[model samples]
Target: MTLAAPIDPLAGAPGAYRDDLVEVVRTRHVPIGAIRTDSFAFWTDHDRVHLAHDLPAERIDNDLAGLVAAELFAPGWLEGSELFERLMTGLVVSAADDPLSAWTLFYRNTMDRLAQLTSLRPGAATEPHHGALVEGSLAGYAPVYRHAAGLIEPGSVLELGSCFGFFSLFAADRFAMTASDLSANTVRLLGRVAPLLGRRIETVICDAARVPRPDTSYDTVVALHLLEHLPAEHGAAVVTEMQRLARRRVVVAVPFEDEPTAAYGHVRVFTARTLIEIAIASGWSWTVHEHHGGWLVLDRP
Candidate 1:
């Protein structure tokens, strides 16, 4: 059907970073699949619209359209058949080949779902503050995701705050991924979607600072974009717990202190020095990347 065409990587808003994002997706291909379960009997038209939240800014419409054309609405595939599942699975694998593409697919679908649920057109109206908020918020995680793909070892991973389960899903194919978050509904929803996506993830509803797991349970423990949601004391406690639970390494990320926008419930911000200091103070050697956000990797002493 050719819903969209592959976009030119170079074509985007000025300093838009379209190409860089595409490169992130290419570095590691996360496993994605579309499995038809008795639970979700059919991928209906409503389902497609329901899953996506809202459209992105006009600048990336071509990119978004290209993804739909490449993955979901491919020409000559029988709609509402096993072929659809195959197409979806292929899309997951292919999108993983380019992190930007995967990001596009994920966010596009997510925005659609959010739009339908909230009745707000996220990218359409484009108020300066709102538009900047949406754009900055979305792009802020690219480097963090890229660094995680590069640094995480092939082993079990425990993600402390798997909001929306994006990174967990992204890494599930390569690592035995488990996620914990405070919201039980979010945890429950991730459980529902994991199987449909052909990924296995253990979900736990617990406080991040006191996960009910033994020390050194997973090889890598991820706490991306979590610290800002906590006070310094609570964040330190979570870090302590993260170190205790990780046998080998811990990955942490936070928005830079100078970042202009703040999401709801964010209690603090951090910088390269602050994040590195936090890790070293816990007796772990670390490396910090001052990109989109600050990403820090700490290894056991």
Candidate 2:
């Protein structure tokens, strides 16, 4: 099925879409018959679509929920039944055996939504659905970006585990920014899109725990929404790395869920107390607080 926007090369080619889905079937050793196609090729049974891979179901659900939530911010496109079907379709497609395909799809859709949102005339009236998709997706995380931006010190900044690099793009005007992620594909995509958006962001492919930078390499080091996806020991190591790489301050943010959200690939939860513990462990002057989520800010001597 055709997407709302044409799939460009950056947005996986039409052939790449088919090959990726086939690769998913091959990797999972699932029967080719399980694959179904419409808007996307997904694994399904005669009854309904199924997650036919080893990826965490909770993580996939979280990603799909973000897409579905966008619909809620601006209703009327699809009724209840149709929305449910859309959500299920997204889940199965996202849960396919190939994670790179899922990330590519997310990048394409997010860029498309943001493009539609930004193309609007300032203060101009438009249809409810025009920018609703992006607005809904940004609702939860925009505040986190704003808060992180506020805490940023003077001079250059590095964001580890930058994912899609949206926060880096948001703060590009105020600071020299560098976005780093473990996935080279994500970094490459961000590198391509940053210039297209008229922003100068340096993108790097590096692990957060062992970033190849000298001590105090950047004025500020930020890791928003990245810790929950790591184990306790690894999270601490990242904190140490952040401290080692920052001259001014190290900022860390995590969602305050009762339990980790599997759909987001979160392996643990963090609270105000937990953040305080992290701060104390760092042996630095620090502040722990919450707004959209828990935050731990460590000031360098």
Candidate 3:
């Protein structure tokens, strides 16, 4: 379930453990995005999309929109869509008639479209970058943080390297959490679109090596795809920083795919054995779990 030194698994995987394709989920109520929820598929006076997971609007399509979004922005998501333009206009009209509905509408629509984007699932790594990097939205690289209940708490969240702040926004909007990223441009772009989605994100540009705050600031800290970017030693240091900031838990996921491909970006590639050793040496009370593309999740105390 892990890789050791001498063979760092996170190294930009060649042939990325994932397949190179874009997947998306569709629903009726959703004009052109994934099905939102299990409510009646209908639009209100304010022009909103609502639908549950059954009935005429049964839960059918659920593709890789989030993943694609993540991949589009090189680990980020695009908030600058025509949809937002329309939503903002609606918000002005709905603000007076239905303020509560107005805000929820923003969140619902934002999350809905966000879900449509691609995920980092199984193939983004091996695929050619091409035009995917434009618009700063990776349509196919969403990290599955749904299971990380602790990370989604309505509290402060400190992410080590929020490449594009996609996961950070997911945590903040869905769970009332706040997110911070290390990249200035990433933070700015994320900030511009955050308010439109009815979410608030506080990003700080700092070296992942030393986050401004100490450990225990955030309920959960996630370094989803960051490890692979640094040399083994720096990657470990980033893990240490995440642990210090996470008051409750630290979650890490790394790619498991083979190397020599265009997607793998790590200086060293790891095998199963070394993966475990690195987790331990990094000072994370680690537990490796199964992740897409043969990646591993190490949980720390």
Candidate 4:
């Protein structure tokens, strides 16, 4: 299936696009404020609460508690109590030792919960798809997350096309993580879901092709599984924008042409050579020797 926009039709949207209720902010600097988009307010401010503080410690439990707790500060945030309990209880059965295992469980479980509440399927824009397909797409990018964790320098981190905000939450442990997506609803989903799971991630609505931030604003910029969804020339434009926004390195990942996969809304396939060519043309100096999940690591230094 071919799409001009490369947007997934079955990826479980929260509700009718509520531009007003979709955007929420809670920080020391800004008060809990919102604006109504069209007419109806889909949700209320009470839905967004300090979940960790309001709910008992026992209620907020998960297999990744030991690994994720250290990164989250007290008075942690969350969107819904019912959803939180349901998600944590669902994950208690998994006994994975690795940190990545727990993260994967959290991501999949939350996605499942969203799928149930909405009429979201997994397939082409016109067809109904299954949950396993979406889960596979999520897991396919694990190597990119692992590689970025090791190479990321000490500074602010900005992840373009940060679908689900899992890596952004993971990177938040080491750096100030900011996640951006073209859709406000997508960013809003991360902003709501991250805090509920006791993960700290700052969400923003912006286009990867034209981020509003200034040049050299972040130490590292990452775009994973996003290039394949764009035309080669458009992908290059995003790479150029990533270079402008990044000070040290711009790490990107697309599906390796050799791997067998089925991903929705993926427009173009990329190989190591083609990705490297784009990186070189974008003025990146050093290429990290290590490659995982078809990662193209381009460092300016």
Please tell me which predicted candidate would have the highest lDDT against the true structure: 2
Per residue, candidate 1 scores C-alpha lDDT tens digits across 51-113 of: 111223333321232333333433422233223323332233234334245435554454333
Best by TM-score: 2
Candidate 4 lDDT by residue in tens digits, 1-301: 3322322212221211112112212112323352222211112353232211112122222222321221221124223323332223222322233323333455556444333322322221322222222322333334456666777888888999886676786667688999998867457756766766666877878878999988999889999778876777788889999989898898887765553222234567777677668867877675634354467777775
Going through the candidates in order, what is the number of backbone clashes in each? 13, 4, 74, 1
Q: Model 3, residue 115: what's the lDDT? A: 58
lDDT for model 2 comes to 0.64
Worst 10 residues of 4 by lDDT: 12-21
TM-score of model 3 relative to the true fold? 0.52
Which of candidates 2 and 4 reaches a greater lDDT? 2
| lDDT tens digits, residue span 9-67, model 3 | 11122111111111111223345553233222222323232221222211111122222
Off by over 4 Å in 4: 1-139, 258-263, 288-290
Global lDDT of each candidate: 0.57, 0.64, 0.46, 0.53
Model 2 clash tally, residue pairs: 4
Using TM-score as the measure, name the better of candidate 1 and candidate 4.
Answer: 1
Q: Per-residue error at 151 for model 2, in Å?
A: 0.9
State how far residue 222 of model 3 sits from its true place (Å).
0.5
TM-score of each: 0.57, 0.66, 0.52, 0.56
lDDT of 4: 0.53
The TM-score, computed over Cα atoms with residue i paired to residue i, of candidate 4 is 0.56
